[model samples]
Target: MSKKVIELDALEQINLDAAGIDIGAESIYVAVPPGRDTESVKEFPTFTADLQRTAEWLKKCKISTVAMESTGVLWVPIYEILEHHGFEVFLVNTYHLKNVQGRKTDVLDCQWIQQLHTYGLLKASFRPPEEIVEIRGYVRHRDTLVKYRSAHIQHMQKALNLMNLKLVNVLSDITGVTGMKIIRAIIDGERDPYVLANFRNKLCKKDEEEIAKSLEGYYRPEQVFVLKQSVEQYDFYEKQIQEVDQQLESLYKKYDPPDEDNYKNRKKHKPRKNQAHFDLGDSLYRMAGVDLTKIDGVDALIAQKVLSEIGTDMSKWPTVKHFTSWLKLCPNNKVTGGKVIQTGTQKTKNRATTALRIAAFSLSHNNKSALGSFYRRIKARNGPSEAITATAHKIAKIIYFMLRDKTDYYDLGENYYQEKFREILIKKLHKQAANFGYYLEPYNMAIPLVS
Candidate 1:
């Protein structure tokens, strides 16, 4: 028997001018096409001047495009510099680079990336427009501050507990109007429980007498000190969050203003807890060209968060399905031998998905909306987790179409949804009965039974 040799054709070079970069904290590895220079691969320091030199060398090699892994924040500077130099930058996800079989090193990684880019095998990750990116930065920072503030609020609660105070048990939130006033008075050296309770707001559910009893506690000096410091820290973060809200407001103003007539008849909704002090509904409406809050269970805060993550551009996704798949809200089924082996949504840290899920969960409190009815129906069939994912997926599709077409959301009401669902159930029953050689009929049409 003769041994046959196999020959494979090389992949077509789609991006001849492509280069690759492996970014590091203090250094960067760059790779260009062979023969572009004496050394096709080189290492450059990550300093600003050195990054500028790296760009110049790539330009000298006639490279017009670059591919790099979205490593931590280390890749950000290089990506920006390359983009500033007018080079087409592809911020490829690191997971996509893990499929190649080989010993992994910085030099080899850059070479592999370059090879992939030459063959047009890499897909760029989605990044919103620059303006949206700016808004995202501020929004993310605000979220961090909010988290910090929450920590201090817990600290205040711990101090109160140590002092044997039951203020939290009396008031819904210690940071609310009545709670804050009483807390400030306590910090200001007011030791009389009745005097502190005098600061109670009119809207407080508990009577002044009850509040006074809750305030009568063993206020140890050490615990009071902790409480004072925690209050100060919480106030500091609150100020910082307000500043971020101001920045967001400024950014929103840069977008085309919304038509006043559209909001003329809009119902006013009080801001939810920890929501921005500014008019987030109006700002988001102006920026997105659609009132996302009109969707059932989506409030101004949820809409703002989703918009900040995905921006106003729905063109990034080709269709609604693509949008939900990117969010990992839809099930990803894996099959083998024509049998599905796995089915579930991919785990993701996508903030937009989280916001949508929160919006979906909020529907449980609203039984009159169509989305609320749909959520309940799903929850009955599956568990709460599955229900939340399905509802979030549905909401995501609605948002995609709304943003893409710049249309308003109109709820058909829960009654309409229930009737439609009933019709669907009837159709399914009829089909099943026919398959079993039986027929489904109205009760009035059924044969009478003898006693």
Candidate 2:
């Protein structure tokens, strides 16, 4: 009798070929691989009950790997459900699994991912680790709430401006203390914007005086009602932002220095000399370092935005160019027979690039910074835009090394290759000077006079 042996072909690490799940908001399309006995693909709904049923159903099939495209946040729930159920699940990128135009259909999208996956042809994007994923959700939702609040604030501004309430003219913030009090009084049937502006606290006396001058906009009770709704929405978002910040504060401890609070007393006392220097990820301030702030012109916020979006996972990128290329930074190359078509990448208008631009602009005014030198260095050849990108590209490389190597940043010095270039220049100049019979000395010699 032959001993029983388990035969496997479709299984790779992470269950690469069991089935394919394509997710939409309300529905999910699952594609079971072609079986020896079946001809058409398997189809199913992906409801909670249906998902539980799928576990029992898939066990009956001989699928060894499960693959799916990450459609949206919708894909996440199902992916977790399926992965939790022990199916090999792949969260593939839509870019990597592009289908031929005519052959594309929703159901076929799942089928395509399955087909590519079965043949082991699927490539996936870099997903952050589980900790990063969880942290990302919190950070992303906070961003959405912030944007929502901004929209509400803008609507209120438009409403007030429409009413001709010079409240904005008098005060920088219509939602500010003096402005809010006057707006509320107006909504409550206060006639005089003057009387309303006077509703200031002791701290708001100066603000009140200025707001009174600008409280001259047109007033309608109906418009005031509309403004109230928008103000409420703004308040709701503010609350949400606060809650998220609390969560972030708790999570930040992992990256913050153990003695962060000690910084207050750092001027009076020093850390133990035996202690090691810290990495950038050690604090929000330190992490700001990777954001190219040392390059000058890069703001803390922009630097933080870059780190927040991509995390410190430079290993996903082999080089700094690869990282920027992923960001659509350099240029998009569409070619036929190696002839170029589009010269530059589509304008992404990403925060990271904005930070880089800030750095570039700063260089224009900053003569002491290496970023300033780099800007001048490249501006002579490529112009401001390219020079900024070149500087940004350099910053990205610096960021990668800082994050991946877990090292402190050291400036390359404004004259990074100055000694080498000087040596070469001296040799060339001396060769000519020698022919002319005039003795020459190397320009870089610290003591020019021979002692």
Candidate 3:
């Protein structure tokens, strides 16, 4: 028996002036609609001049929208150029563009993207506004510097360990004031344990005698040299990080100055160890038009990092659900034959999602906040991993609404959440009892216990 072939209606063209580009490290293949020009598809070298010519060619073909696969950093220059030329540039995800199965080549990919985009079958990936992008760059670089500095810190620790120094045992952080001073004194040829211990800060929990005991180590020249070099690298990265902070401060100046009264009235928070030196809370509040730090477990640093990643413009997401879905915090339920086969959140490298997760994790130890209670309740039902995602989802929704509606966060207390949860449990119990041909009555504690 011969199989019947199904002939579906052709997809209607929705973007008449759409074009597609397959960008590569050395060259790019561009495809315009058929009959737009004598040569509908053309290849261009990946040079600034050639990119300009590519834009000019697209203009010649009357293309006003362009779709391109996000092929690493290769697409950034072209995307910026096309956007600058006033074309609606869609930086399409590779996954979306890979659904169509056929012979694959750069030329074929460009044409396929063009065909899909022309029919409005493509979605542009979310990219924050240019101002946010600038802040993101600086913030990311600072994070990198911090990571690099951490490695040098480990190096210093290793050198200390080789020489039998036990500073890490007594101090919370080797980069702290007392630790740094002792380390500098060691690098400066001070071998006397008593002299090194004298550098201890007044706030140090360890007394001079205890610090001196820890400082008693063999003064190996080789280990001392490594410690010196590691400290130098650490200081260098510190300087670089400070420079980036200054740049960020200057960038924040471009935005509207924050309200002085509001800034002064805001609650002061103890700065994190690696937090930027500037008034990050004020700058972030000014940019976002709301103090995200007002939310529990979301400090100014986390707020700054998240805002830099996602920007303050919530219109890009149509709703709070859409925002969380974009962050990949919501579960992607896979159903087969009306049965759920899988339900898990998609793995994503979104920085905003990471920041939200960090904020959620911080709430694990907070007992006073309603969100903390919710997190603990979820953790009791599911495992810790699921609890983190669930709490992050809640936080993401709160952030979305706060930013979208321009409203302040007013956290209901932990007791309130607990009472509401108790009420819900009572209602569930009553319904279950009714289903079992019984009714629930309030438990009485007024009666005295029998002896």
lDDT of 1 by residue, 354-427 (tens): 99999999998756889999999899999899999999999999999999998888899999999999999999
Q: Write the per-residue lDDT of candidate 2 for residues 194-259, one digit (tens) a residue.
A: 687678656653565566666766777677888889888988888887777667555655663534
Sum up the clashes in candidate 3: 0
Q: What is the lDDT of every predicted structure here?
A: 0.90, 0.64, 0.90
Q: How big is the RMSD of model 2?
A: 10.0
lDDT score at residue 358, model 1, on the 0-100 scale: 96
lDDT of 3 at 76: 92
Candidate 3 wrong stretches, greater than 4 Å: 1-10, 260-265, 447-451
CA shift at 231, candidate 3, in angstroms? 0.7
TM-score of each: 0.95, 0.67, 0.95
lDDT (C-alpha) at residue 439 in model 2:
78
Q: How does candidate 3 fare on TM-score?
A: 0.95
Better model by lDDT: candidate 2 vs candidate 3: 3
